[model samples]
Target: MTRHAELVVPGGRYVLRRARIPGCFLHAPSAFGPADADGSFLVDLLIDNGLVADISAAGASMPADGPAIDLAGRQVWSTLLDVHTHLDKGQVIPRAVPDGTLEGGARATIADRQFWTEEDIAARMRFGLQCAYVHGVSMIRTHLDSHEHLAPRSFQVFRAMRDEWAGRIDLQAVGLAPLAVFRTDWGNRLADLVLQSGGVLGGVTDALGVYEGAGDAEMDRLLDAFLMAAAERGLDVDLHVDQTEALDPFALPRIAAAVLRTKFKGRVLCGHCVSLALQPDDVARETIARSVDAGLDFVTLPTPMIYLQDRKPGRTPRWRGVTLAQELLDAGLKVAIGGDNCRDAWFPFGDHDMVDTLHQSVRIFHLDQPFSRALAMAGPMASDIAGAGRHGRIAVGAPADMILLSARTLNEAMCRPQADRIVLRRGKRVMDPLPDYAELDALAGMPA
Candidate 1:
């Protein structure tokens, strides 16, 4: 047996032997066994042609032509997936000091946008991606600023990065435009840009509440237009809805209603929905039911939401800015938690590590009593929302994108985070250098 710390490359073939993994973490749900005796199993995985060719008992025969790696009973899991992030506006901390309010963060972001050249955005985005990749995230879906003036350039830069980073990390983009823009010719233009780049159509429904005198009629029109455009172009829809803590009319139900009315053919995803936590139980249950009826998916960004919602200067926060994750899960709605912003104007503190996000969410949502639920949020649940089929699970014929951690159990993995983790992308060990933002700054002709 080869006792290598990292799997070797060039050959693109290896047999991971004696790797202990949770039964629930297996790709096939039916394979999950009881948590007592069959909770953790030692298995041998055969990798061939960038896929898991076979898996068997620990002492099974190894691939004749490939080296066998001994995991020594450490835990291994499928690489994480980030369903929602703001890559176009990441890594601008300190440069854009937020005033600890959502509106203030918007102002800071707009002010900083004036200095965003293609080089600057690309460098920052590349750095964020590198951090996420190193931390075992194999797939990410980033929401880009789609203002009329900023989107074209940002999209151009993102497209170049997408092509450049292909095969290493799967990058998906969404054009996050204001809700009102969808009612004008600009909406058509935004749709065209999104179709051109093969990105999802995204709008911020929470901003609709800020529109003076904008009632349900106006909101419905804007959402209908947005969904119609996406349906026409065969694109999916992802919206930032009801991010505020106010009990104002929840847009989640409205969004679901609009999807039903528009007869949309693509998948619909709603992020935030923080207001759901504040709603009365009856109202929240009704809204969740409507959302499930419409086939809508949900992603909760706990970090940024907690940082932005109910935040009044000089006052302690009363509520955690997270969605009703447990309620959604119990209602059988697909819910995933994501690391939304990383060192950006919105939140200003993250390393794009989903494990860290998982840790925080497990506490905030009280998901530790049954650790499997929390684990799914960072792994399988997020992957389901990402729609990047077959990448976030471990099974025969599945893509071998996974992380090897230095923990013996789920509780140990969460309580004691490790830095010496190994990442594999498609059966090959990834050894890319972490991004140096200072060098990127120099390359962009900015001050260190």
Candidate 2:
């Protein structure tokens, strides 16, 4: 209770100890076996069946000399939740990032990365899944492109991952089709394919931006058809909506209106409402208010948006492709940040950890200027914003999924994150750190 210790729990080592608790009612650590507020309580931890269930005081008290784990005062918060991601089709163009594009600099991304075999996807999923575990991302909603009628093959790979990792990670797969692909009736088969393949029903709106001709209206109709099919099948929806300078704020409002009318509000997640960033503050506020009022959850991809933005000189360039993250928070919207791409054509590099994504976001949004706030944001605050649920906290009933850090305080742990930060999927031991975050950093650009 007052020292550094690690006990073998599900998935990995269970490290527990004392620390200054964050000043939030929801985040206070609880005592085991009912004690005075002043006395410290045991914090049981484990990752099993894929969920983090920390049952320190369930029906028993700590034995006088039984097994114990001191987390070295490191915080044991709930596992992280990354509500938005595209693990299957990263970079939309993976091989071209480091080498730049054929046009001298980096080539612009049109569709997601292609030419990946099922083996390639499986390998990528392995890396992404493992990295996600270490970074405390216990849950992920990933979109996989089904553009070339690849859902049959791709879904097979994702299913294997889901079956293999089961409780280790809550993985949701979405079938993605570009608006152009949809209008040409290419996605028609893909939608039905995703339905049969048993994945989430999802699509992209910005793909509509690239539409050239009479294809535009037809694409809209296809999107509607896809949404309807998803609804008929009782599937949730996520869309890559309004992702360019050409996107109008009204476009998202229109979608929100449709969702409201269809009563599919909470089931719909609208990603990268980039148009919100271009609008006036009031207008942006009102637009999101309507969407949230209509029950649309939001997913912001800060890193990729920053990576893709035209940082060109002057001209009052108007596209950032990021939703109003902090502003949406201020509006009490259910919003979470996700790593949109890793080493893909869109973003040449991403370490695959939610912490990395969170770190970048803090810097981009000026959330880390104070330093101290940045550390806390990496854990508690990040969890809250990203729907870590009862996760991202060290409380009763929260998932036992946790990371054991090397530092005692929040600051030290973040400044030097470690693989020693044991990752627990539930109550089962999954991995022990022969190598940690240090090695992970050193071996950058490798698989995951």
Candidate 3:
């Protein structure tokens, strides 16, 4: 079968003709009938005024007043959501190289901060957002480093871009501050900025030991301050927790306990938590139980973790630097996987492609036992965690945010390069030109 070129809907009602979307992909189970002998069912989707108005059996009579594009049995899936990414620091590789350690990456990133003009940050962030949009991602939540000197400028650029891309893609920001700063005037200032820009409060848990040299009592004080501030400001909290291989001084349980004690009403999301994988089975189970009790959500960024964890010069690594995702999911916690960094100083690899992240996650986390569940790590589950509860699902009355794939099966969808895919935002096909690397380089004041 020949792939269908993307149909540009020129802003109005339209009908997707004879599309064969999978039953598993539908939000409503009854939308599609049982598959035929070839494991496929044909349907027609009517999208009107930026919503799915109707879905009927294939060849059903429908209005052809607007335009009708034949899908030719191509599979349709929800566009992806990325809950954890570093847009402020993306696409700055080779220019700012890390020494292949987490500490080294932090140092290198801080050193490169001298060159972070607002224009430079905006250009790099726009480049990453464009890549994500073309790759069929409808929403993203990026973390911006929130030092006292840098955060105001970073938030300024991010807020402007949030408006700039409002219709095409939803952008949410998190102020990635250090926990040690939470009790200081600087922390209050950061909270004010976050509240002004409608962003979440974020911090690094592992940094308590590495950067601040904070012991147990001090860690508790810092965490309490952070949670209290977030509660006072009515903001959600997203934390980078236990991002190291060391099993001792585990911060996940402490964080969960703090959330419960502080009675934080907003959502609490924890990223990384790699040390959970190294814990004894019973201890890990207890930690998961605590997290569930505290109403915590998780996002695992396997690519960066795998790149930075368990690495010593000229030696084979012992463990993959990822969290216990399977355990968390099996325990009924909401776990999502994300593409953490794209071409950044910290582990220089990744495009902002959630499909690629899902494919890799299926391998790294052993998620292919049941294909549908594995796919959810990047789809509906991730969308819900990103606070886009109505997106990443196809149903009557839902926003027409979807992707048309050329593949017939889930395996094909994961394995094949999706070059021929068409992305839709609010029922309209997105046809923005992909950004050129040379152009981005020029914008960043780098040689092409």
lDDT by residue (382-445, candidate 2, tens digit) is 4554344555555544555555555555455445645555555554444533223333232323
Give the Å shift of residue 387 in candidate 3: 1.5
Q: Candidate 2: lDDT over CA atoms?
A: 0.58
What lDDT score goes with residue 248 in model 2?
Answer: 43
lDDT of each: 0.81, 0.58, 0.83
49 in model 2: Cα distance from truth in Å? 12
Q: Is candidate 1 or candidate 2 better by lDDT?
A: 1
Name the regions of candidate 2 deviating beyond 4 angstroms: 1-15, 19-62, 91-94, 98-114, 180-188, 207-223, 247-250, 313-321, 368-399, 409-414, 427-448
> How many clashes in each structure?
0, 32, 0
Provide TM-scores for the models. 0.92, 0.75, 0.93
Candidate 3: deviation at residue 257, Å? 0.7
Candidate 1, residue 357: CA error in Å? 1.1
How many clashing residue pairs, candidate 2? 32
Q: 188-300, model 3: which lDDT tens digit per residue?
A: 88988999999999998876324366677777888899988888989999999998888867899999999888888899999999999999999999999999999899999
Model 3, residue 428: displacement in angstroms? 3.0
Shift of residue 43 alpha carbon in model 3, Å: 3.8
